[model samples]
Target: MPTNQLTAGVCSLLNEPQHTEDLLNSTPIVQILSVKKVHSNPNAPNPVDRYRIIVSDGEHFLQSMLATQLNHFVDEGKIQKNTICRLDKFTCNMVQEKRLLIVLEISVLEQCEEKIGSPAGLQIPPGDAAVTPSTANQTPAAHHTAAATGGATASTSNTTTPAARGQGARSGRGPTTFPIEGLSPYQNNWTIRARVTNKSDIRTWSNQRGEGKLFNVTFMDETGEIRGTAFNLAVDALYDKLEEGKVYYVSKAKVNLAKKQFSNVANEYELGLEKNTEIEECRDSSSFPVVRYNFIDLAKLQEMAKDSICDVIAVVKETGDATEFTSKFGRTSTKRELTVVDRSGYSVRLTLWAKNAEKFTNTDSPVVALKGVKVGDFGGRNLSMSSSSTLEINPDIPECHALRGWFDASGNSENFQSHTNSFSGAGGAATFNRSELMSIEEVKAKDLGTSDKTDFFSTRATVMHLKADNIAYPACPTQGCNKKVFDQHDGWRCEKCDRSFEKPEYRYIISMAVSDHTGQAWFQGFNELGETLFQRPANDLVAIRERDEAKFNKLVEDVNGHQFNFTCRAKQDTYNETTRVRYGVQKILPLDYAEEARHLIELLSSPWAQ
Candidate 1:
């Protein structure tokens, strides 16, 4: 193909449905219409250079990107406005809202001779007439609340009121309410009259491209719902004027493709409140629906993976005192745990964090409707509130009323199935998973022993054998104390509580090999637990072991084949550069056949199982 004589072949490729991969494989020749730098960052760790260019098939203009490695084309002036080039190799991929053509291999077929006819703005292929460009990769929006907007409110006196902003429509000059679904990167002249269903706390972030603070709010109507964020200066401008559950006559909100991970709204696009945005409180909000919630049943929570957001309605079976703790982030946080149960007969712990925890109150068995709670499996399956999540205390919903009635009549203390901790709230008690039971193999599959905090679980296991190599240890006998005392030959020295004792008290430290069908684990049962397992106190065991080695050995053999429910605490420890799960037995109870059968039936009857 000669330079200028390449002809119509350059224009024919625009209509072909073949994309980036096809272009790269075929290496089609094309003409460049316009060139613009879309993104660049000298400070980026890997250094990025991106460009947006409009390529044409002579009839229609299509937007494409130049590969980062091809920056020299623009830097050295090889690619310029009105340049004709062969897209020898390129790739087409969807970057947010736009299908970008990334040119990799190319040759300059012709230099910028003169401006040819400007192809009409990209052709709206049949079904794409209403399609809007993707708003991703645009400048990040700042969503500042009235308080966080800071001095911006006081500095600017040009704010517009709802009536004044809508005056153009009254005059027929038109800034009419724009359909949220009608928004696009192509249009900036839009006015949306919607209700602010929800707004988030202001958050700040700093990055390579820039640094600024932002906040997000969701607006909805009978037609659909959309979320919008205001950044930096814009936050100060629009935040105070907009109120939750209030109607607003909003205009000039920039529309962007909604980031799938961060948004819960079903809309394909979201909006950004900018300086030019006009928002006026509307008088009536009959058009917008109340907050939307598609709650999942509490019984079904076990089926959900961690980090999934869900809503649920349940009765508060129990509540804990609001406690404070210094978080790793160096900030003090409040936490409160609530044991909640639904009609499905399954109960789970719900932990409220920070402000929500501080504000939580349940004097009685109140109905709670939580939205956007995160699924967590700390010690057990639980629901934790997220920063943006919301909860209602005894909401007026039918489910709430039905739960109250059910809980008050029967589901109170003894009837409900508790799938959580052995003791409710902050007892530091051993906990179970959603199934209320776990096999030994699951202990490793769930990565239970690796957490910084000790993990608790209960399993029905048989005691295969006892470790006789090390049985009881001498310890300080002080009441309410369980410290190892020094055997000084003449006298014992107590160091921990700090005191001297004439003689040391022996404490039971039983080691046992226990197993469920899945696997076996070495468990250490200390003092009380050891006493329960062996059916003998520490001093009695010490006397027996000292009295007759053969008698002590028989006691251990007699306990074999006995079964008990073992509550184990697992912690991760690294030794010789390898991490392993170390099990510590906390409590032990005689296995009850009736309780196990009832729990198994409950699991089988769960809605998720169905």
Candidate 2:
């Protein structure tokens, strides 16, 4: 029995009634009599990483553990002899011959702040202490003898080594762990053992709060996955030690709602590592799952809303040439696109950014699995690797292996339909729809594209005529700029732009007469639109024209009489004081005659129709 704290004092509970025992079972106030030198492990193979302290309430004295996390408090002269502390969390467990007092958290009230009686044995009722059946080997009399000198333990030797004591144990049982899904911003005092599946590059950021470097890791277990970040000193201490696919025992982290803008993990909460966080590598990670993936099929990607972060696994049907360009923000970026397909017989585009683009190796159209790709609908449905996204080529996932096998077998024979349109900027006219659309004749009537902003409109037009000679030109191969170029002796040169390129991109700049029932207009089609119209790459057309002039003429004549739903950007330009409306095909869509007829009907029925 122990005295209750009347006012900011100390108290303890009697260890009796076995299962009903209190004290360590509940939060209490205790006074430290002396910090013990060490404790021995008579049963464990090695000593554990923990310390012992003799604590007393006004009446009873007991031996308690100084948790490894709070060892710094003792070294820093914070929790010493005669210090009174309120046990924030603690437990009492019976391990064979030892009754261990384990404290998870504590708050120091003061050290010898108030004068009281000397630390002594519990003052229980006269007969109550003597008749306790819980006292096995030690009688009530021997209990006092043990309390006077030190705790009653099986090992009286002082040979317990620090290595054995550092095993992070006190009672017989080990730390209890919970799943990541059970974690939330409101919960506390939980431990989780998980494997690091992904690790982000160390990045530094600054704001009004402060500045520091941070690295992120995706931790997953059989239950679920969550993200953990270490900052500044924690980064230097833990980053090098934490490797992907390694398991770790972590506890005492600050959990909060995850920021959707930065991560694609499904967890509602993320962890923030603190100085007191206990992270140690686990020798065995057999319990952790390999990973968790909610992969969206390539065919279903087009149905997803824009900006949604999702995962996908598909076989690479083709890969684009890598390109390096400066973004609008003045930051240089590298990019490449992959045309991927799945069993659904449908294809879509995937744009890998920065280092991923530069390091890509699309050998033999490998199966590519990506996580956290941002869905985009610039002109049509597409995918772009997000900053926090991860890319894996020919991964070992089941879907990846299946896709690889299928592509090698029957997938190559089946023609796949593309979910995306022309190329990158074909999305230039993506913002416009049937409502904002106007015919080529209406474009001329309204004097469109002359305003500061280029007027965009879609029309159902047929290629009635095309200039068979010199319909294509050699242009700068560089991405972001497709201006025409000249074939100098050494290489291709764009004299007007004052730039020379080692590789010249063959691009289409064909002059064509597009006609509709309303009227006809001249439209110039560029590389992407030209490729779509002729169903041949600009480079192929250039080669055919150079190899055989008559063959080039035949290819140009092939596109004639074919109708298409075209999205065009109109701009007026004047050369030699002869200003004319220049209609450039921004996007070339499949001719859906029924959809086109319905769209025309809507335009004609409008009140403002001419």
Candidate 3:
């Protein structure tokens, strides 16, 4: 093909003569001069279709090819600026705004040829060709024998011809690596330089087998984020060395299909660092961005469902009771509850368990930041705190001061109320009547004239008739459920279930009579508080009532006529919708209404009065 028919535009772009004889008759070959321009074509069906060229001596030939094709040339082909390419031929058709050219053939040549050659034969000088037989015979016999023995080695070295080297260099497996671009579609092994956004300290776990240590770190590259865990030996190798906010050249990581349900990121896959994984600290810190979060308002946390994780900033309004308990592992644990409030006109309870409880006990009035706190249900509303949750007390972070100022300026402190108004020494003394002190058996035995108008009230009642002594038994020690149990020796048996269990049951009250200056009421207590007030094991009380009624009556008399201040709470029962009240004696003191006893004391002290 001759090059004469090439257009002036092509000639000017190629900076070469345009002639039909040179294009059609002469070798139809050309060298890539330059990539003058590259851009996507909107008119193409595939939006990724692009137009580019190798300005071989610039018959500015425009070609319509897939975007992937251009990427292949840049990636696999290793084509770059100033690269030389030989264009065998191309299809050109005139278009309105831009010329359209389709590349038909191409050859990446090292350099431009000085002279054109015939299509039949191409030759080089004799010195450049392989040695002839005459040249080989000119050497000595001993030299020939040595050459024969080393012929295999010589052949091995010659086997990698210049052509082979060029092909190998272009195979996309060379030491001069390049970053992958336009990877929105391809899913394959990829190397990225990511920074250690978060790292975990070495944590040890002990089991029957042995004790081992493990740690994990979170990494973030420009492309995405991933989590890596190191165990045992790996922990010792990398735990102290891997620092947060430092970049690292990580490679040999295994890419696994990510479970979207378990991940919060946007990527479809995640990487795992294995034993063979390589990591090297990157000196340049400017390559990665700092970790940050736009925390959600704490007031909004009320609207979220229980167990929902949230980030919040709020002021600590008040600290709560610190309760200590034994965990399943037989370890002592303590937890303190606090109320955290924000500008949203809503507040939630935060229970800091274990270490957090002790640490925040003295932080009575400080602003706090909570991340990954699990919302929970407490007293019919959402509460939040978790073991993995992070709590910052009066941190230098701006959010802390902002929330503090807002709370102070808005008079938010005035709105803070005790979690339990009635139980926190707020409500005054309680009162109860004799009729309300009737035991369950007594109430059932009584044949009242009318249910609504029953005159059950009585004065000077003995504690013997007020307590459910016969029915009292050790109840389950579980936090919420406190049903009485039957003794089985091996373990206490639950009367409600007719089953034997391992854990020891607790003492709880089935009923109690409470009175004050105004009125009287019947009350019940669950296991823990019930046992505390009764001052006896529920099982022992039950046994005493069954074996010796006279003794039980004496014990009741000891508590009778004991004038004491009390507090009570009433809530409608779910079974009958009847109000069931519970009360505890707050303060017990000598009765002022005992006139006979006062006279006796005055008679004994007559000398002072005289």
Using TM-score as the measure, the top candidate is 2
| Off by more than 4 A, model 3 | 1-201, 206-211, 220-226, 244-250, 255-271, 286-288, 320-326, 329-336, 353-364, 380-388, 393-398, 416-610
Q: Tens digits of per-residue lDDT for model 2 on 1-610?
A: 2333522323334333132223334567777777764433222211223457867775667666665456667877888877878877554432212334556678887767553456555432232221112344433333432332243343333342111010112221335555553454433556777888788778787779998999888888654568888889888877877787788888877876566567766655689976668887877666446666667777887676667778788888889989875443334579898888889888877898877898898788888788767877643567888655677777777787788888899997789876654343445454436556577668788888888778787777889999866667777655556678887887778765566767677777678998988899998866566766676567777887779989888878888998877777888788999987788876677766798799789879888696
Relative to the unseen true structure, what is the C-alpha lDDT of residue 31 in candidate 3, on a scale of 0 to 100?
A: 37
Best by lDDT: 2
Candidate 2 residue-pair clash tally: 9
Q: For every model shown, what is its TM-score relative to the native structure?
A: 0.46, 0.54, 0.38
Model 3 Cα lDDT, one tens digit per residue, 1-610: 3332222344333222122324422223343333433433223111222335434333332322222334456555445444445445433221111223334344554443221221121122233222122322332321331231111111223222211000000101212111211111112233445667656556677889998987667666432355566778777666766787687766565555444334333233455556667777767657254443336765565455545556677787878777674443434568787877776666667778766787675454788877556655333234555433456777777777888788778746466432211111123323333224444343334533224332322223223235544435566544434566666786777565555567544455446665444445564444433333344445566667779988876766565554432223333343366533223332222223576478668867888566
Error in Å for residue 28 of model 1: 49
For every candidate structure, what is the RMSD over all alpha carbons to the true structure, in angstroms?
A: 19.7, 20.0, 27.3
Error of 1 at 443 (Å): 16
Error of 1 at 187 (Å): 6.3
Model 1 stretches with alpha carbons more than 4 Å out: 1-188, 204-212, 257-269, 420-512, 516-610
Worst 10 residues of 3 by lDDT: 162-171
